[model samples]
Target: MRLFLTFCAFFALVAVVFAWEKEDHEIFDLVSSIQASEGKDVNFYSWLEVSPSATTAEIAKAPFVQAYRKKSMQLHPDKNPHDKKIHERFARLGVVSTILRNKESRERYDFFYRNGVPVWRGTGYYYSRFRPGLGTAIVFLIIVTSGFQYAAQHVNSRRDLARIEDIVRQARQVAWGPRMVPVEGQRKVKVNLGGGPESEAPERWISMVVDANNVYFLHPDGDMELLDASTATQPAISSTWFIALVRSSYQSAFGRSNDLKEAEGVSPPQADDDELSGTASEAPGSGTVTPREGQTTSTSTGKRKKATKRR
Candidate 1:
């Protein structure tokens, strides 16, 4: 529960950091358009020909109003129809003028003007400003999801390593006794991984061999496998669930195709063997023929000749 709360709090903080009000987005849109239409160094105050610290009262008065009207007339679409972005600039100008006209909106713009707008205003801001295509969105999702999966893998790998270390330590303690002094020869021992003496559930035991500085798994067949950093599963991009699943699926499909090809290749020889056996069974005989016990070979030949002459 505590961990869940911590994660929620973390996401909340991130959301807050990325959060921008609708009014703030309007200001951002205005700033981006003005810079894009005019020059990079031009700002809202300079574009409107007003002072950054100018009072709202001054902005509401004639001088500011006249300057805005003049700029609006110059950027209006009808006056410059050849300019494809003239209407956008004209609309952007109106938004800018409105922001300066209102005291609250003006203050918001002033703050950003002084400090400069943020370079990155989160994905929502960018998505609204420049709508990404499907391909770009998919690539973005893959990158984000893969990054999260990779981070989760690292967290799990650390946990698994800690558990493995604990098990190795327990095995070493059992083999070397209380002092845990380095033993010269390998000593085999069993470590209880789960279920205590008081628990009714069956205990899980792992047999291990301990030497002077190392612990090894003692297999049932008397083979020893060393336990170290390699014993724990490591974190990797390829090990992330999505990528791993894709790779495994591809391998499975390829393996099945190869198996089908092998089956096809092996069939022809078996079919040929079956055909040979069939032909042999269909044949009259394989050995030399002999006459019946009472008949001679010449008598049979004369009878076949007489029968042919009659035909």
Candidate 2:
């Protein structure tokens, strides 16, 4: 329930972060366009060609109005038809002018203008500057999820190790008695592996052999398995789901290629045997022949002799 509450709170915060108002969006757009066109360090006051301390009344007057008109006329799409960004600039000027003319919006802009605009403002901020491709998002998610899986694996490993230690301690206590003195011989004991005093279920018992410091679980078929840290499943990068999937895919492909190579390699040896049989039938004497230039020969009479060719 606590974890669920944490998740709910996290999502609530995310909703608040993305729930930008129309005025906030306008401010974001105005800041983005001015910074991109004019300069990174440019702000609302400089973009309007006015002092930072200018009052809303002063800004609503002719000086600020004239500055807005001047910039708008220069950047108007009709005036600069060849400029693809003129439309954006012209629209941005209108928003900036509107923001400075209104008492409420101008104060909002001034708050940021004094305190400085946030360098980052959630998804919108990143989308405006650094939009990721589909492949990039996939790779990023894989890395993030794989990292989380590895962390969970480590947590599980620690838990398993603790369980193993607890079982070992129980078995050792049965063998070594109250003092837990070192025992000379192996002692078999039954221990409650789970559902102890803390649990409502009946105590579950298992037979195990305790030899000095070593502990082993005894099976019904007279087989014993050692129980220790080594028995616990260890965490590793390869154990993570994504890495395991990739490794299995690679191994399957490699095994398939090897099987194909073996299948292809078998026919060549059969062909070579056929060629050797044909060569033997074409030999001069009634005997098996090897495909070598100089060797001993057994003729039809079964006499061994050196086979040679005369020019």
Q: Write one digit per residue (lDDT tens) for candidate 1, span 1-311.
A: 99999999999878965787778888887787778879988988899899977899988999998999898888888899799878778888887888888888888888898888887677677778789899998888988999998888788889889988998889878877888877788788899988878998789988888887898988899899998878888888887667888999999999999999998877443456634532434446763443333333345446532212111
What tens-digit string does per-residue lDDT give for candidate 2 at 62-171?
Answer: 88778888877788789899988888878777777787778898888777777776765667765755789999999999999999998998999999999999999989
Model 1 misplaced stretches (Cα beyond 4 Å) = 1-19, 51-65, 76-82, 102-123, 131-138, 198-202, 267-311
lDDT of each: 0.81, 0.82
For candidate 1, which ten residues in a row score worst on lDDT?
302-311
- Which candidate has the highest lDDT of all? 2
Q: How close is candidate 2 to the true structure, as a TM-score?
A: 0.69
